[model samples]
Target: MHIHENRPGVLTALNQIFAEQGVNIAAQYLQTSARMGYVVIDIEADGDVAEKALLAMKAIPGTIRARLLY
Candidate 1:
């Protein structure tokens, strides 16, 4: 998992979650504004991990949204 956040620790949390699930992120894009943050993850679509990862990130603090791109 990857995340774009102006606040610290959000990205690290996402990375840890992905690692625990054995998901390999191929590419990622992260952008932030004073108001919110955005995250896009590109990964090999092999299982439900993408969906789970998105859900996990979406549940985290400071995350406005999460999406998986195949």
Candidate 2:
């Protein structure tokens, strides 16, 4: 997944959401520049639940977009 946000609390919020959805983040990668931050998260979840979780992630404040990579 890709998360576009540069502010604090974005990752924490995402973690909370994932926890609520019963998804476990297996791995993650973060890259930040002066203007933005991008996070790629590898999660373990059921297919249906993963879709819902991605949509929830997209709805988070400061998140420009969210999508599954595979």
Residues forming the 10-long window of minimal summed lDDT in candidate 2: 1-10
Model 1 off-target regions past 4 Å?
A: 1-5
Q: Count backbone overlaps in model 1.
A: 0
Candidate 1 global lDDT: 0.70
The local lDDT score (0 to 100) that residue 51 gets in candidate 2 is 88
lDDT of 1 by residue, 1-70 (tens): 3445468788788877778888887776777777566666676655577777778878878765566554
C-alpha lDDT score of every prediction, in listed order: 0.70, 0.82
Going through the candidates in the order shown, the clash numbers are 0, 0
lDDT of 2 by residue, 18-57 (tens): 8998788899899887667888888888789888888888
| TM-score of candidate 1 relative to the true fold | 0.70
Model 2, global lDDT: 0.82
